[model samples]
Structures are given as structure tokens and as C-alpha cells.
Target chain A: MKNWSEKTLKRIWKGILVAVLLLIVFTFSPWVLVKGKIDPILFSMPYHLWVSILSTILLVVFTGIGGMVFYHLKLKTDPNANL
Target chain B: MTQYLLLIGVLYVGVLFFLSLRSRKEIKTSSDFMLGGAKIGLILGFMTFAATLFSTFTLMGMPDFSRNNGVGAWIFLAFSDAVMVFFILWFGFYLRKRVGSESFGGMSRLLQNCYQNKGVGYLYFIAVFLFLVPYVAIQIRGVAIFLIEAFPDFIPVWAWSVFIVVVMLLYSELGGLKAIIYADFMQGTLLLIVVWLVAMNCLDNVGGWSALFEQTANTQPDLLSPPGPKGLLSPQFLIASCIAIAMIPVTQPQLSTRLVIMKDYAALRRMAVAVGFFAILIIIPTVIIGLYGALQYADASTSSFLGSVLLREQHPAIAAVTIIGLFAAAMSTSDSQLFAMGNEFRGLIGSKGENNLTPIRIAIFVFAAAALLFSLVSSNELVLLARLSFSGTGIMGPMIILGILAKKPQGSFMIGLSAVALVIFIVSQLGWIPQQIFNMRLDLLLMILLSLGALINYYVKK
Candidate 1:
């Protein structure tokens, strides 16, 4: 059962990694950057700036989530793992 | 202001010496000196990592970068850092696991063992030394310039630079890595506090967040958007920067050593997450401060603008603390890089150098002296020089990743590829070759080719 759970976590991590790469690529894309578009501001920030901030925050959240899953998987697979 | 600066500066130096002396008692072996005994917990691990990664570049360069380039500086640094911390989770695990069975040394030594070739280690050392010296120098140069601007005719910039290098060397040589880590914790906290206080003051002066952006729009709407006023933050440039910055953990020895020294995998992972949040927290203030610079000192010279805003405009007490904070910022990062390079040299020289800290100590002094000389001649383009350092060392990302992740380690070709790419990048930076080829940046293209090369090597060997 532990092995099975570990496998599931590993799969989730792989998925998260893919999602993160996509998010990063999209954040750097023309759609998000949209040169000279300062409209649709939030809290007085320009479009690209706010979007970039949001993207950074989202990436941090993903990092937190990814780290938790990674920790559990490592604990399971390498029981004698050097700390 | 001078009195406050003198008081706080003396106190700060006293604390640094106390920490160094205390750490000296813990040093019984080379590992204790070089790797801080490799038993770091989450808080110290994250703070040292954060402090080392975000140095004078973040504190001094970012505000000026944003003031000139606009909000895209966020994407340039903070966004890049967010990706970097996540990369750490993956890379750090593989690295720690690989080194788990072996006695850990610097990355140069580890790569030598990984590839069973001395050339791999030599290539890495040369690449890192060529790039990191200037990176370390700029830390000295940035603070030295700021101090000169803050106090005219008090001391020459070169003298200030020498003073910083001497103080940093004295403590680091005495206490070793443990002392550096403790100092980093203090510097990191001080950095966070100082930047936010200054940013809050800047924000208040410019009204709130909304009004600040409005005034910036009026001053230079280009500062409010992408490509910026100078078009320096174009998508291609930012994308390239993101790749370079994200590769920092994989390529930069100072950070890579921190990854290896964490007490456990759990601590390493937690450190990564904490660093991510820390990156966001540290960078946001620089943005506010940058936009503030835009409102007031947009056209002033870099030193002039920073002095007026970071020193002259603030309360005397606050200004004094800011000066100390900047000084601490420079030392926290420079000392680590200098020490890491010394450790790398020790790694290459074998156990003779390791068993006796004397040789390593001398190497550290030599490296510091070289950096001081470089600092004297280096430009004031702090952010760009830093990025170039990242990009130059970053070209080794594929070589290092292959070294770390390979199962059988038959990727000797990467050494030559990285060297060739490093040379070409340097030549282009020197303007012997065009910076862009077929409308793509040369550095970006080289990175793509190297990654592909590593991928092909991995599959073929597997």
C-alpha cells in the first residue's frame, strides 16, 4: 500500500512538473506580455506587471505543492536516504 | 547620519566577528570549514541560499533597473526566481541522492568523480572562475560606489572596496562556512527589513500603489509595460534570463553547495519553498522602490540617484541602517562566492589542500585580491553585469545537469561543448561576434543547442 501511494505521488509530481513548465512558457508568451497594453489594470498595476506578479505567485504555490509531494515520495522510496 | 552609520556599522562588525570566533571553535575538520559540516536546517539553509542568491544585485541593481526599464523587471528577476526555486526541488533531490553514497566535495570535484575525468572538473573551474570573479567584484563595486556617493571625500571608492574585501576575508577565513551562514541569516533579515522600510516610505511619498503607477505612467508610460522604455526586457531577453536564473542552482557552486549541505531531503525541499516565498517578498519591495526612483530621480546617474533616494531623502537613522544593510548585502554574497571558489579549488587540488586549511585560506585571499582588482575596473551596469555572469556560468547548465543526472556518466563531449560555448559567448559579449543570429540571441541559441546535445548524449548512452 505504501508503494502504491508512492507511485501515485510520483505520477502527481510528474503532472505538476509539466503543468509548471506550461505555466512558465505561457507567462512569457505574447498573450501575457502583450507589449504596450497597459489597460485592464488591477490595483493600479499595468497589465503585464500584474499578470507577471500573478504568475510568480502561482509558481510559488506550485513549488510548495510540488515540494510536499516530492518529500513524501522520497521518504517512501529511500527509507535509508541520507538526510 | 554619520554618527548613526558609525554606531550601527561597528555593532554589525562586532556581531560578525563574534559569530566567526564562535564558529571557529566548531571547526575540527576540513568538512566543517568547507561545507559547514553539511548538517544545515531549514532556516539557515534557506536564509543562506536566499542571501547568496539575492545580493547587491537585488538590493542596488533592481530598483535602478526597474526605474529605467519599468515593471518588466519583476518578470526579469522575481518570476525567474520563482521558477528557479521549483527547479531546486527536482535538481536538489537528484544531486543529494547522487552524492549520498559518496563523500561530498565541491561541484568541481564531484563532477570529476562523476565523469571519471579530470578535464571535466578543470573546464568547470575555469568557466566558473572567469564569470564569478566579476560577479563577486560587482558586489564590492556596487557597495563601494554607493558608499562613495553617500559620503563624498570621506574615502576613495577603491579604499572602501579594499576595506570590504579585508573585513569579509578576515571573518570568512577565521570561521569558515558556518560563520558565513550565520552572517547570511543576519544579512538576509536586515535586507528584508531595510528594503521594505524604504519601499514603504517611497510608497507613502508617491501616494498609494495606484497613484504611484499613475505618476509613472505620466512620467514614462513605457515604464509601465513590456519591452520597457529601452526595450531591454523583451520577451526573448526575459525568456533567456529566466533560463539562466533558473539554472543558477545547477550551475552556481555557492548555491549548489548549499543544496548539498542541507541536513536532509526534507530540509532541502522546505528550504526551496521558503526561498521561493523569500524571493517574492524580497523582490516586491525593489519594484516599489524602482518605481519610486522613476518618479523622483529618473534622469540622475545611477550612483547619484541611489544616494539621493536611498540616503539623502530618507531619515538620518533610516539612511544609516540602509547603508549598513547594503554593506551587509555585499558581504553576505561576495564572501560565499569567494569561499565557494576557494572550496572548488580545494576540490580540484585533492586531499592535501583539504587536510590543511592553509592552502585554501591563501587561495581565498588571492581570489579576493583578484576580485578587488576587477572591481576597480568594472562598470556600474550592476544588473546587466550580474545577468552576464549568470548567463556565462549558465552556459554550463547542460554540462552540470548531465554530470549530476547521468547514470553511467559518458558525457565528456559536454565539457568541450560548454567550453566552446563559453568562449563564443565571451566573444559576442566583446562584440567580435553578433549578439543575435537569425533574430535569436546568441546565448539563447547556444543554450538550446547545448540542452539538445545533453539530451542526445543521455539517450544514446542509456
Candidate 2:
């Protein structure tokens, strides 16, 4: 039981690590600048504007899903696990 | 309109008073008073957390920030908040596992437990109070001026400020954290309903979302892009804002306590997701109102633009409810911080204070009075002041992360460095030093310095 709990905990941490890296790379990467464009209006908003709003929507969604899955599935496996 | 607004405002206060009066009886001990006995369920927890997180800043600051800074403002808050909710997952689990049903004394007490040095705990307390008191002061001031602008004839501005402090204190003093939490739920719901209605009206005036953007671009193209026309939302500024805001859940004592006080892990996780959803729904409307301001109220002062967008343009009825909503937002957040300060005092003095509720309440009153005095003296730039609060607290973020994650004592070295970092941040805030250090925003620079120092401190201890 302890071994299984350890594996589940390990996987959750790995998932968190990946999510953090993805956020840092896309949102704060100095190499990628998604601003200054105003001509290409996507669905009435500027490309940059739509992109910013969409990206935030995406981040919020991912956080919700990630939090739900981790807690409901892995963390539930062992109440005693030091998550 | 004024008469109707006055009626609704009184009704709202009456509702808040009833809630506080009923909940006050639950306070049998200091822990019950400070944390609601850690019995907060999922929905209530989510509502209070959302209410606390979304404050007058969203209603007043964001519309102004977007009007002044353009699309980059979304990156600053909406995205930053989404990221911060994820921090709750790890921070909550670790801290709860360590504390293990131990009534939370205060954040400083938690750090003391982790470091085993009361000095390090005191260092953390002093640094956070230095920054957070100003934070509480500015929130009070921000809404006081808003109310003043909303009602110019009634009592002077300073009187409005005093009223805000008194209302916040009474709300918390009556029922403690639970009262504040219930009030938050009411405030959060009112803010969401009223802001969205206001946004729809603004959008209708400017012609739907697409037309709003088209009009804005035609009139003010810079309002649609980065650095804005005012050159405010540069990449560095946006990135620093993201870091500062994202660190909030990890560093803010009021917020961290919410995580621990949840009924269980499942409740915490669900509450976090709810907060994230609330963040999106609450923020998107502010963007619309800001775009409306950009199109209609360009070249207007922030106060006049807010008065126009939130009041004159909407139905007088909505304009009135919004006043009540703004009052709710400011009180919800202000009371939480004030109460947290009181709790921190109780913890710092050592948690044997099972029967020391009166002294703690007295301490909270002193702090509340101090915040009121500071509010009268502070500036009126809402977003800038809010940003300063975030960054000042953000500088301490890594020390907290290190404390929670550390398996052993990392010693007094990091504590010494933390004081230095705090001083650098304070001096920069006071205009005594360059706002930017080495071409990066000073807050972000400080984060990097402390992070590296934490890494070294870890290895040295090993």
C-alpha cells in the first residue's frame, strides 16, 4: 500500500512540474512576444487581444481540471500519504 | 437615485450585521475566532476565497488599469490569478500535512515551526506587517475616495475613510473570520452580478464586443495593444505583475489561512477551481468596461472615467447597487487583512492564548486605527498602489516556499538576507532608489536574488 501511494504521489508531482514549466515557457518566455498586432481581428477583437483572453481562459481551465483530477484520483488513494 | 441607493446600502449593512451577530456566538476560543474552527465547507470556502481575492481592485482598479494599459492588463491579473490558484494545491497539502490539525496560530508561527527559530519567525512577521499594513491602508483609501466621488455632499472624505475602517472592524469583531466569510459570499455575488450588468450596458452602448474593439481602434489604436498609449504595460511590467500576483496565495497570511481552514483536501481542491473560474468571469467584464472608457472617456481622469462608466452611463438603480457592491468588495478584503493581522499578533505572542480573545481584539483595534490614519495620508493611484502591495509582498515569496519545502532547518542566513531584501524593496518604493535595477523591474530582481540565496542556503545546510 505504501509503495502504491508513493508512485501515485510521484506521478502527481511530475504532472505539476510539467504544468509549471509549460506556464513559464508560454507566458513569460522572453523569446515570444505576442503583442503589437492590431489588424487581424479574430471574432471582433484584435489578434493580440483575443490571444490574451483565450490564453487566460485556457490557463484557468487547465488549473481547474488539474486540481480536480489530482485530488479526486491520486490523493484519494491514501489518506495517510503526505501529499 | 440617491435616496434609493441610501436605502439599499442600509439594507445591505443590516444583512451583514445580522450575519455577524449570529456567528459571534461561535467564538468560544481564539482559534474559533481567528479561523472559524477550521470547519469551512467547500461552497462557503470558495465563495469567501473568491470574494477576498476579487476586491475593489477588480471593480475600480482593473477597468482603470485596462483603460490605461491595454490588453497587457489581462496578462497582469487574469492570468496571474489563474496561476496563483495552482499554488494552493501544493502549499495547502504540505502545510496541512505538517501542521496536522494543529490550530493555525499565525503564518509567522508556521514559519517558526518550520525553521525552529523564533527569530526567523519574528523576521517574517515584521517584514509582512511592514508591507501588508500599507496594503490594507491603500484598499481603504481607494474605496473611500470612490465613495467620496459617488457622494460628494455627504460627510467629508476623511469621514468616509473612518466609516470604512469602523464598518470593517465591526464586521470582523462581531463574528470573526466566519462573519467575514459570509459577508464575502454576499459581496462576491453582488460584485459579479452588478459588474456583468454594467459591462453588458457598456458593450451595448459601444455596439457589441467586436464593434467596441473597432471603435476603440479607430479612436485609440494604442488601447488595443501593448505598452499602451501611456507605455505602461511593457513586457517586464506584465511579467513582474504576473509574478507578484501569482505569489499572493503563497505569501498572504489571510489567503494562506483560507487554504488550511478548509474542511478537507477535496474541499480545498474544489474551492481552488471555483476561484479560478470566478477569476475569469469577474475579470473579463472589466475589460469591456475599460474598452468602453477608452472609446468614450479618453483623455479623462481615472476618477471621472470611473464615475462616468460605473455611474452616469448605467441606470441610477444599478449605479446605486454598484456603490453597495464596491463597499462590499473593500470591506470583504480589508476585514480579512485586519483580522489576519490580529491573528498574527496572537500567534507571535505564542498560542497559549486560548483565553486571550479580548487582548487580541484590542490589538486588532489598534491596527485598524493605524490603517485608518495611513489611509488618510496615502495617494489615490489605485492600480499602482495595489501593484506596490503585491510586489512588496512578492519579494518574500521565495522565503515562504523554502520554509514549506525544507526538510530541515536552513538556518539564520536566509533570515538575514530576507531583511536586506525587505529594505531594498522599501527604499525603492519610497523613491529613494531606481525603480528598475539592472534593467529589470526591482520586484522581479529581488525575487531572483532571494531564490538564488534560498538555493545556496539549502546546499549549505546539507
Candidate 3:
């Protein structure tokens, strides 16, 4: 049971790591590759709107990373950490 | 005006009622209600933090400051967030590790453990309650005014106040922290969208950043500079801003709760970065909007048609969006304040065990009523109220820092800081003290002396 829980936790952490990296890429990438002028429906909105959307997305991603890190830290600290 | 406000009031009351019903099953104990069973994940936590931080003051007042004072106000406000984030990163982990209590009030308990003095615990608890209740009342008043101003057809200010109070009480009583946080998450997202749209619309109306800057420089160059016409950005203002920044984190009940809800040090660290970034995004636009308003209506007073028309005369499509944003900002903070005050009141009445939350419900009503009464009687502007709250918290700021540093902060030191802070607050409020003293602002001077006194006591004991 302990081994299985450890494996599951590890997998969750790995998934979170990939998500964080993807979020970082999405957040930093400013270039939108389109064959023509930016489509209003697809890419155009107010600048502040775009910033809010990006900031909210980043906030969620970072919070996920924080949760995963917390779980791992708990696992290390407790004698019977996993339920 | 009253008829429209009534509709808004009814809508808010209905929402509160629904939330209350949904949350009824969740409130099994004080911990469940107060800390959400300490099981809140990152999403809810982030939202709750965001909601509490952005109040009606931020929604309405930030723009107002920018309009009157310029980008300097924005910078000063942004500096508070940066300073708070830095402190969170530097000290949050340590505080969380050392004192695993669930509330800022719990920090007082920790101090008692260190000093073996219940009086110290009582002092901390009293200070938090006295200041936080008034701070919460300020938020309630801000929301009432915003509602009255925004939806004159559907929500009368008094009815709106009653509606908000009822809604907050229901959700808070029923859902506890869980309901509050979930509501906060939704409200925070809505507020972010609403403010962003307002900023965009304002920019578009003003013919973009360059035009806005040029207009300000050409028409009202003095307003573009620090210490605008009122000298708000002078060294005295800057010093006061810095002191406020430091003191804000220590006393803000919403931010202090972040420590309790966090899962661990890593979560706290991530929260710091996320919250810091959000603060930047949220504040800058509001400030710009204020400047936008100023540029558009250089001679218009806030009470003038220009001020009202700029915000309210949006396109039909965006009108609902603007109202929602304003509502979200007001409701977010109002709900959190209700929850915090409820908990504090429970503690004050000496309630414990499962019955602790009973007084909280009553306390919420009392607080809401007090705020409503104050709103009716007082015409103190939002910025002035905000500054007063910040300065009020400055009294407890040194003691919070000292409690963290000292294994045993002497009872005398805590009492002394409290007394001195009280005197300064009273003197400033009474207008006996000059607004600027010794080329330093009163708040800055008080904070310096408080810190120095605490440090001296620490060394003397050592």
C-alpha cells in the first residue's frame, strides 16, 4: 500500500511539473503565428483583458505547483504521511 | 433611485440565501467554518486572497487617487504589494512553521505560550478586533455607496446595504469559510474582467496612452507629478506610503488568513508570487483609469456629471459588465470582513466548542448595521477612510513583528506600543498634530518609534 501510494504521488507531481512548464511557455510567448492580420475573434481583445486572462492562468498554474510541493514536503516530514 | 437599488438588494439577498442553504451541511465545527477544515486547495485559497485584497476601495478609490494625484499614487500602492510579497517570501515560511495556529489571533496564543502571559494574548486579540471591525465596516460602507451610485434604478443605498448584509450573513453563517472562499473565487474572476474592460474602454475613449499622457502634460501637468496640487507625493507622502505598506500586511485580516489556509511553505511562496503579480495587474489599470478620468474631465469634481457619466455612460453591452465588476469588488471584501469579524466576535464573547459560531451571526448583523449607520451620516471620501484604516493598524504592526522575533516579548513592551500607537492615532485624528511633523509623516514616525522601542526592549531583556 505504501509503495503504491508513493508511486501515485510521484506520478501526480510529475504531471504538475509538466503543467507548470506548459503554463510558463504559454504565459511568456507573445508571438501569435497567423497567416494574416490578427483576427478579432481569435486573438484581439483589450490589452488589459489579455493581461487579466494571462495573469489568472499563471496564478492557477503556480498554485498547482505550490500544492504539489506542499504534498511532497509533508510526505518527507511525517512518519505515516500517506493516508 | 431607491426602486432600482431595491432590485439589486433583492438579488444580493437571494444569492446569499442560496449560498447559505448550500453551505449548511458543511459547518460541522468551528474549524470547518473558520478555516474550511484546513482542506482548501490552491484555487479557492488564491481566489479568497484576491477577493479580500480588492475591495470597493480598490475598484472606486484607486481611480480616484490616480485622477487627483497621478501615477505617483499608483506607484505608492504598487510598492505596498511588492513589500508585502517580499515579507511573505522572507518571513511567511518561518511564521507558519513556528506557529501552526489557524488565525492571526492564534499568533497571540503563540505569544502567550512564549511569554507565559495571558495578558499579552488578550492585548493582541483586542487590538485585532477593535481595528479590524472598523476596517470591515468601512468595506460594507464602500459597497453600499457603490451600489447606490452604480444602479440608481434598482438598488437604493439603504436597501442595498441591508441586502448585502443579509447575503453575507447567510453565506457566512451557513458556508463559513468554504462558502466565502468559493464566492470569493467567482467574484475575484468577475472583478478582474470588469476592471480590465473599464481600463480598456477608458483608454479607447481617451485615444490611448500617448494621448492621455499628452493631455495631462498639456492641460494639467501639475496633476501628472508627485504631490500633485495637494502635495500628495511629497517626501512626507512617500514616507507615509512606505510605513502604510509595512503596517498593512500585519493588520489586514484577509492577508493574515492566507497564512492559516496555506498548505505549506511552498504554497505560501507560490501565493506570494501569484498575489504580487495579480496586485500589479489589478492596481495599475485602475490607477490609469483614474488618470484617464482626470484627463477627460480636468475641471470636473467627483460629484460632477462628468465623473458619473464617464463610468456609467458605457455601451449598452458593457453596462452589465461594469456593474458586475463593481459588485464583485464590493462583495468580495464585504463577505471576508463579515467572516473575520464573526470569528473575532465569537472569541470576544468567550464562546468555544461547537457553539462558538453562534455569536458570530449576531456580530455580523451588528457590524453591518453599524457600517450602514456610519455610511448614512459620514461623507468622508473612500481614500480618506482607507488611509485612516491603514494608519489605525499601524499601532499593532510593531507588536506583530515583535511577537514573531521575540521568544518572549515582555508584556510591558506590548502595552507600551499599544499606548503610544493609540496616542498617535488620537492626535492625528483630532488634528492637533500637524499633517507633516519633523519633515516626516505621522504614521512613519509612529512606526519608527514603535520598532525602535520594541528593539530596545528585546536587547534589554537579552
Candidate 4:
């Protein structure tokens, strides 16, 4: 068995960083600004309202999916032989 | 209707009493009392976490917020909660790694070990204590105000508040966190079921989702956007809220303790994801209820709007069940917090050893009583008061983050810096200092400075 290499750890941090930045952009940036400004009705709701509702659902699903995969990979690649 | 409320209330209280009795066997030692013997499996772990986080704030405070602020409430809570849960996966792992599996009284004790300075523990507890009191008070206050509104002819506000604290003290002093966890599971399920039932009815009454949104958009489209109609949920405010709430798992001892008590990282991971979905599930119904208010009670007062939606809008029988659910939500959240304070009080009063559990129990009762009194005197702006609590505790987040991520002893510089920042925050709140610097919120500014201070200390010392 091998220890968790620094390269692997760095990759994990990089993945987290990207996820954080993308979340920030989608939530706080012009993406929300432009879309949230559009009051056009969509699916019985305004565009901004739909964005808030749909975007939240998307975030939950994305995180749930992302976390499950992360757990799987980490378990498979755990450095501890007995784990 | 009155009889129904009493029956359901009695049944719920009976169940809690039974759970407390059952848990007595598991809580012989201090560790067992504090962390449920560190054996909470997936369902209990997830529900307890969700229940503690979702609170009267969700059951009562949020629907009122969304009713007034419009759809921005989603951004305020749901989005931030989603982000928080994602962060939880990594943060939970880091916290468990540094703190170990033993229940070390509370968060302050863990920090005391990490920084090797007792002052850090004191300062951290002081920061959290200052925030947790009003935070718990609002939970009591939120439900108390609503209970009076629901049963106005009966209980006065303060009486309702005191009743809850007494109930909280009873179960908590009996079985401690173990009792609170089981109680939380019951409360969480009640909260989810009752809110959804009321929300579906609200939807049906408001002519469903399409009519509710169409009515709000046609009558007041401003209710659907950034600042909302009341101008409370601005982009900057929402952004600051996201930051404060996202830091909750780090700064809030009740939640951090839950992280340590989970069976393992696998349980924690599943708990985190479950919480994310729970956040959506919980907040979605509140938004629907809020929109229903927009349609039916557009110009009503907050109390009136909440009463109509939570009580008057439902059948009398369902309204009775909903009241019990609201009481359960507030009690579950407050019990965790007051117990966390007790844990902190224990650690602060005796860091050298664990010889006096009696003092902690007394402290818990005192804390619960204090929250009841504070509920009488506190502001009625539930979400704002809650955000204040978040930001106050959040100023201490960088130190905890630094501790969790650091590979070696991080020293006391971060501690001193955070202590000074916490002092500034309290002073600012008391009107002794400007609440904002450079046109930015003082709490947000403190967070940036604290994080920078942590980085500098890390680089220089290690």
C-alpha cells in the first residue's frame, strides 16, 4: 500500500477550488443578475423565480451526486490497507 | 380543536419522556451523555443535524421572510444551505481528524487542545455564547409569538416562552445530547409532515403554483427579484448571509458536536448530502407558504400573515397538529443550543478535568432560563436577529478553519486576533463603534481580516 501522494491531495484541493468558484459565479455574479432581472414568466413562474427555485434544486442534486462519487473514489483509493 | 391540540401535545411529550427514559441507560458516563456514546447511525445523525439547522427559523421565521421578501428567500437560505452542506463533507472530515472521537465537553475544549492556549477556548466560547443566547431566545421567541397568535385567548407570550424552556430543560437535563438527538428525530419528522401538508393546502387555496406566482408577478413583480419588495434581500446582503450561514458548522458548537458524534466519515458524508436535500425540502414549502401570503394576505402584518398561513388557513384539526409541530421545531433547536452552552460552560469552568457534571446541569438550566427572559426583550425581526447571531459567531470561524486545516500547532496569534475581532463585533453591535467599515459590513470585514491574520501567522510561525 502507498500513502496518499501529494499530487493526489493537490488534485483534490483543485477540484474543491473550482467547485467553490463556479458556485460563487453562478450565485453572486452577472449570471444571477442577468437572469434574475428577467421577469418573463416561465413554467407558471417568473424567470427569476424559476431560477431561484430550479437553481437551488440543481445545487442539491449536484452536491449529492458529487459527494457520492467522491466517497466512492476515496474509499477505493484509501491508503490504509485495512480500511 | 383545543382538545385535539392538547391530545397531540400530550402524545408528543409522552414520546419524548419515554425516549429520555430509554436513553438513561446509554448515558451513564459523561462521554455517553455528551455524544450519545459516539454511535449515532445514519438516520438519527441526519435528522438531528437537519432538525438543529432547520429550527423555528424554518417553521415560522422563514415563511414570514419569504412572504415579505418574496423569492429571494430561496437565495437567502436554500442556496446558502446547499453550499454549507457541500462544505460540510470536507469540514466534517477535517474536524473529526483534529478533534478525535472523544466528546471533549464542547467546541471550546477542542480549540483549547488545538491552539494549546486556554485563552483561545475562553474567547471562542465567549464569542459563541454571546451569539447563541439571542439565537436561542429567538427560537423561543419565534414560536412564542406565534403560539400566542394561534391560541391568543389562552397563553401569554412570556408564559409560552417559559413553558418551552422548562420542557427543554427537563429532557435535556435528564438525558443530555442523547435525549436531544432522539427528540430532534421526532421533531424533524413532525416539522416536515406538518409543513408540507399546510403548504399543499396553501397551494390549493391560492389556486396552485401558477396562480400564486402569476398573481404576485402581476400585482407586484418586485416580490420576485433581488431586493424583493421590502428591499431586505439585496445582492450584498444575500452574499453576506451566504458567508455567515456557510460558516455555521464551523462556529456553532451544537452542529460541530454533531459532526464529532457521527459514527464515521461515511455516515457524515451521507448526513451532509441528506441535509442538502433536506434544506431544499424544508425551504421549498416555506416559499410556497410565503407566496400564498403574497396572494391572499399581501398587505397584512407579519403576525397576521403567519397566523393566517400557519393556523387560520388550515382546517382546525390540522392547525392543531401544526402548532405542535412548530413547538417541537423550536424546542428541538433550542435544546441543542442550550445544551451546547452547557457543554461550553462546563469546559470553561473546568478545563483541567471532568469532576463536576452538576455544575454543568445547573448552568444548562440557567442558560435556558436566560434564553426565556431574553426572548421577552429581544427584537422580533427573526431572520435579521438570526443573521446577527451567525455573523457574531462567524468572526471566530477563521481561527477554527485554520485549526482544522493546519498540520501542526498553529500558536495563539490567531486566538488573540480573533478575540480582538470578537470584542469589536460586540462593541459595534452595542452602538459603541461604527457597524460598517469602508461601506462593508463589519462582520464581513472582520472575517476577511481574521482569515488574513490566520494565513500570516501560519506562514510566519510554521
Give the TM-score (0 to 1) of chain B in model 4. Answer: 0.97
Candidate 2 lDDT by residue in tens digits, B1-462: 688798998999899999998888888877888888787899999999998888888898889888877776777888888778877776777777766767788888888888888887777777767767777887788788777778778888799888888888878888989889988989999999989999999988887988988788888888777777888787788888888888887777888888888888778888887898898899989998888888888789887888888888879899999889988988888888888878887888884566778778887898788888888988767778778878887877888778877888778888788879889889987899998877888887888889899988887787
lDDT for B327 in candidate 2 is 86
Residue B325 accuracy (lDDT) in model 3: 57
**Per-residue lDDT of candidate 1, residues B1-462 (tens digit):** 989999998999999999999999999998789888878899999999999998999999999999999999999999999999999988998899778866577899999988889999988898898889889998999999999988899999999999999988888988989999999999999999999999998988889888898998887898888888898998899999999999999888999999988888888888888998898999999999999998899789999988988898899999999999999999999999988998898898998876888888888888899899999999998999999999999999998899878878765788888889999999999999999999999989999999999998888888
- Please give me the DockQ of candidate 4 compared with the native complex: 0.42
User: Model 4, which residues run further than 4 Å from truth?
Assistant: A1-13, A34-36, A69-83, B350-355
Give the per-residue Cα lDDT of candidate 3 at B255.
Answer: 65
How many residue pairs clash per model?
2, 0, 9, 0
Model 1's CAPRI class is medium
TM values, all candidates? 0.98, 0.95, 0.78, 0.94
Q: Per-residue lDDT for B338-425 in model 4, tens only?
A: 8788777777776432655777887778777777778899977888889999999999999998877777779878888888898898
User: Comparing 2 and 4 by TM-score, which wins?
Assistant: 2
Better of 2 and 3 by TM-score: 2
TM-score top scorer: 1
Query: What TM-score number comes out for model 2?
Result: 0.95
Task: Name the weakest run of 10 consecutive residues (lDDT summed) in model 1 chain B.
Answer: B97-106
DockQ of each: 0.73, 0.53, 0.04, 0.42
Ranked candidates (TM-score, high to low): 1, 2, 4, 3
Distance (Å) between predicted and true CA of B13, model 2? Answer: 1.2
Give the DockQ (C-alpha) for candidate 2: 0.53
Better of 1 and 3 by DockQ: 1
Candidate 3 TM-score, C-alpha based: 0.78
